[model samples]
Target: MIFEFLLLVAIILAIAAVEVKDMLYAVLILGGLDLVVAVLFYLMAAPDIAITQIVVTAVFGTFIYVVAVNRTGRKEVIE
Candidate 1:
């Protein structure tokens, strides 16, 4: 049941990350998704992989995205 809940949350976060208009919000949502995936990995008995996922993806990935968005702007350019 917990696994299912995390999966659902991850799916929702993925969709929200894509749908959000602001780049910062999207990056935050993607970070949340990464965290959820890490938790799923932990539950699946892959602690090493889960730790790597949290450190590499959730932390570094989000930092890179935030830096890129900061260099650019938060608003999406639809033109």
Candidate 2:
């Protein structure tokens, strides 16, 4: 039940992340959704993949987001 809930939440977050107009918000949501997926992987007993995903999504992904944000200011409103 909890696993299903987590998966549902992850899916919803992933969809929202993609649909969001704000790039920064979308990146943040993507990272969050990725973390959720990693947790789900862990719950499913895939520790190696979970750890890799967690590290890549939380660390590397955030770094990429920061670089992108720095390259392009976040003040631009997206419609």
Best by lDDT: 1
Would you give me the overall lDDT of model 2?
A: 0.88
Q: Which stretches of candidate 1 lie over 4 Å from their true place?
A: none
- lDDT, candidate 2, at 9: 100
The stretch of ten residues in a row with the least summed lDDT in candidate 2 is 70-79
For model 2, the stretches where C-alpha displacement exceeds 4 angstroms are: 75-79
Write candidate 2's Cα lDDT for 1-79 as tens digits: 9999998999999899878877788888888988998999999999999999999888898889979987997655658
Q: Enumerate residue pairs that collide in model 1.
A: none
The estimated TM-scores of all candidates read 0.96, 0.83
Most TM-score-accurate candidate = 1
The clash tally of candidate 1 reads 0
